[model samples]
Target: MFKTIKNDLPASIVVFFVALPLCLGIALASGAPLFSGLIAGIVGGIVVGAMSGSNIGVSGPAAGLAAIVLVAINSLGYQNFLVAVVLGGIIQLVFGALRLGIIGYFFPSSVIKGMLTGIGIIIILKQIPYFFGMDKNPQGDFAFLQVDGKNTITELLNAINALISGNISVGATVIALIAMAILILWSNVLSKKGKIFQLVQGPLVAVVVGIIFYVVTQGGSMNLESSHLVSVPVPDSFDSFKSQFNFPNFGALGNMEVWITGFTIALVASLETLLCVEATDKLDPHKNVTPTNRELFAQGTGNIVSGMIGGLPITQVIVRSSANIQSGGVSKMSAIIHGFFLLISVIVIPKLLNMIPLSVLAAVLFIVGFKLAKPSTFKSMFSLGWKQWVPFMVTILGIVFVDLLWGIFLGLVVGILIIMIKSYQNSHFLHKEGEDVDDGRIKMTLAEEVTFFNKGAILKELDNIPADSFLELDVTKTRYLDNDIIEILEDFGLKARERNVTVKLISERGIEENPKSYIEFFKREIKRKYPA
Candidate 1:
């Protein structure tokens, strides 16, 4: 870790910048104290970062759970909600210990891709308002139905009108555009010069420039203040810093609502963390696999610490994880260092941090969003065939219009439906007898594994076999013959004599004479002779 400090330190700084505002924004969205988010960010970094099996994944407060946090806090009160969060953390620990982290693997690759694309689109959509200086909703809020009574589309519509009517901050607009230009230049051109230039990243430069712009343009026509800037709750003294830490109210432990909230947070946070781990692994240039179970354990530990300290729930957030990857993070030390940066900066130069414009961070995230949901991604998925593409598109649309979990659910359903259709069509095939064979003889070959799905086709083929015909039935390669198919064969056997059809059963058991009921043959375990 120390050996890679040269690379990890810079990457950590970039992730810190990316994480700072999100922590506060998600906390605000969750209806919790602003400082609580920072606490989670710090814990996710220092605590979870140390324990996680992932080299590149960064854990922190997640936007995905903001809505749930908001409702829980509103109903249970802050202290009581902390109890639920603590309980949730405990539940996550249980999940990790029991090796439930494998649940993440059940998501199809297509669905995962869809999820990544969906999150990217959401990040872009959610950050658009911030980029435009529309302060109605907090930064990082990505839900479909926003807290401000407007959905994402409506908010976009409102933002457009606001931009047209010049109801925007000139300072924010100018700073954002300039920051984005710097980022584009840094990523596209400047960083290629050498590692030194890469060390001083575009976001760091953009933020410094934004701060200068703020200091120079104060009270001017292009000045930005309050809502247009980053807000890190500044601690006035050592005691004040200590006071920021919150604790759970154990009195709420008996409340069923608290338990329900705890379980909800545990399930959602674990899922989000697992998904982000997969996404981060995919984005890792090093191509390392994250140990999913260990990640859960780490995440669960981070949440427990965070909740104990009056922090919002934490997850392996894609936005920050992506930022770390894009910024060239080399190891978990980057995440740990970034956590320290958060801890130190808020206590030391918070006033300076507060000077940086929110628009600059918005610009940074906009670039991240663009990379994750590139137009090329859509085209790539579309070329993969309708079976893969349909679910991918549906997941994107579902996430855009509904929510994250729901979108994946819809996509999974579509994926399974397509699979069933293919199964029904691909169950079996029929072949004609060779010219060398006697006339009126048909050779029927069973598929690799004949399930109930093939029963219909088999019945149709059986009906077409003319009377007094000789049929050669081969089950030599067949495996996993379903009971329904076996029953169909039994019925066919009963009527074969009436049609004067001579049946031949070829198997490892050797060719048998006119076979008895399939139920008897299967009960005798003849079908089990074939390999699966």
Candidate 2:
């Protein structure tokens, strides 16, 4: 891990900057204490990072869980909610032990790509309001419908109206534009000139410049308001900092509602984490595959630790993980070190951090968003044909129009439907008119793996066979057949007798003329494989 310290250190700083505002914002969105978000971030980075198999994935309090956390906190009380979080973590550990991580692999690549692209679009859209200094909505809220009672489009329109009516802060716009310019220049030009430029990242430089701008323009018409800056909780002293931590209420353990909430958190957090892990692995330059089960265990541990103290539920977050990757993170050290930075900054330099403008961070996120949803990505997916493109587009639209989980769910549904359609189409190979044998027999070859999905297609073909016709049932290449298809074949055999149809069954075992019973044949085959 230390071998990549040079890369990890700079990346950690970048991730720290990216994570700080998000941590506070997510906590605020969840109606939890702002410090709790930082606590989750710290634990996610240090504790989970240490245990996680991922070299680049980062975990923390996610915006996706903000609504659930808010409701949970309101219904259960803060202390009881913490109990749920701890229990949720325990459930995640059980998930890991059961090797449920295989669930991540089931998500189609197109859906995963769509997820990344959709999130990128969201990050860009969400930041637009902040870019224009409309700070009514929390930065961490990524859902289409926001806590502020406006959707992304309406919020954006409102920001534009504010700009037109001269109600928006000119200071924020100016800072954001400057930050974007600096980032563009740094990435395209300056970073190429020297190692020094590479070592000192553009986002950090932009943030520093934003702070300087904030200080210089104070009391002027162009000065940004406190609302436009990062808002980390400022504890007065050690005692105050110590007081920020809230312990979970053990008394709530017996509540059935608490258990339900715990399971909900565990399910949602695990899904989000697994999805982010897949997306992060795709984003990794090294293309490293994170062990999903280990990731669940690590996340569960982090959440447990975080809940025992004062913190929100945790999951592997794409924004931070992508930020880490974009900033050249090569090891888990970057994630761990970023946790340390979150810890140290909240204690030491929170006041300084508060001076940095959200507009500048918005500018930073703009670049990240663009990288994820590049126009080239769209063209590439389209070129892959409708099979991949349909789900990909659906996911993007769903994510942009709905929410993260909903978008993924829609895409997954579409992906599965596409698979079913393809399976139906490819279920068998039928001999063309001229290809039939001289004996006027019709040949139908079953696919390698015929599941229940192919039952309808197979049945339709069988039903169309002419009376007194010769039919060839070929299972030469079939490795597995569903019982549904077996039943359909058996029924067809009975129908063949009525129609006076001659049927030939071809298999690896031997050719048969009208099998007596499909189940009996399979039973005999099983016995052939394992003789007494």
Which candidate number would show the highest TM-score if scored against the true structure?
Answer: 2
Residue pairs with backbone overlap in model 2: none
What lDDT is reached at residue 365 by model 1? Answer: 88
lDDT of every model, 2 decimals: 0.85, 0.90
Alpha-carbon deviation at 162 in model 1, angstroms: 2.5
Question: Candidate 2 regions off by >4 Å?
Answer: 427-439, 513-532
Per-residue lDDT for 1-532 in model 1, tens only? 8898888888898999989998988888788999999999999999999999888899899888998999898899999999888889999889989999888887777888998899889989887777878864457676787766789998888789999998987888889999999999999999999977888988899899989999999989998868888989888899998898889999889899999999999999998888777778888999999998888888888888998889999999888888888888889999999999999999899999989888888898888889889999999988999889999989989988887877888988998888777766663544446525668777787767777766777788788888988888887777668778877777788788889888877776777656556447644654466434
| Per-prediction TM-score to the true structure, in the order listed | 0.92, 0.95
- Residues 67-179, candidate 2, lDDT per residue (tens digit)? 89999999999999999999999999999999999899999999999999999999999999999899654488888888767899999898888988998889999999999
Q: Pick the candidate with the highest lDDT.
A: 2
User: Where does candidate 1 stray beyond 4 Å?
Assistant: 427-444, 447-471, 495-501, 516-519, 525-532
Candidate 2 to native Cα RMSD, angstroms: 2.3
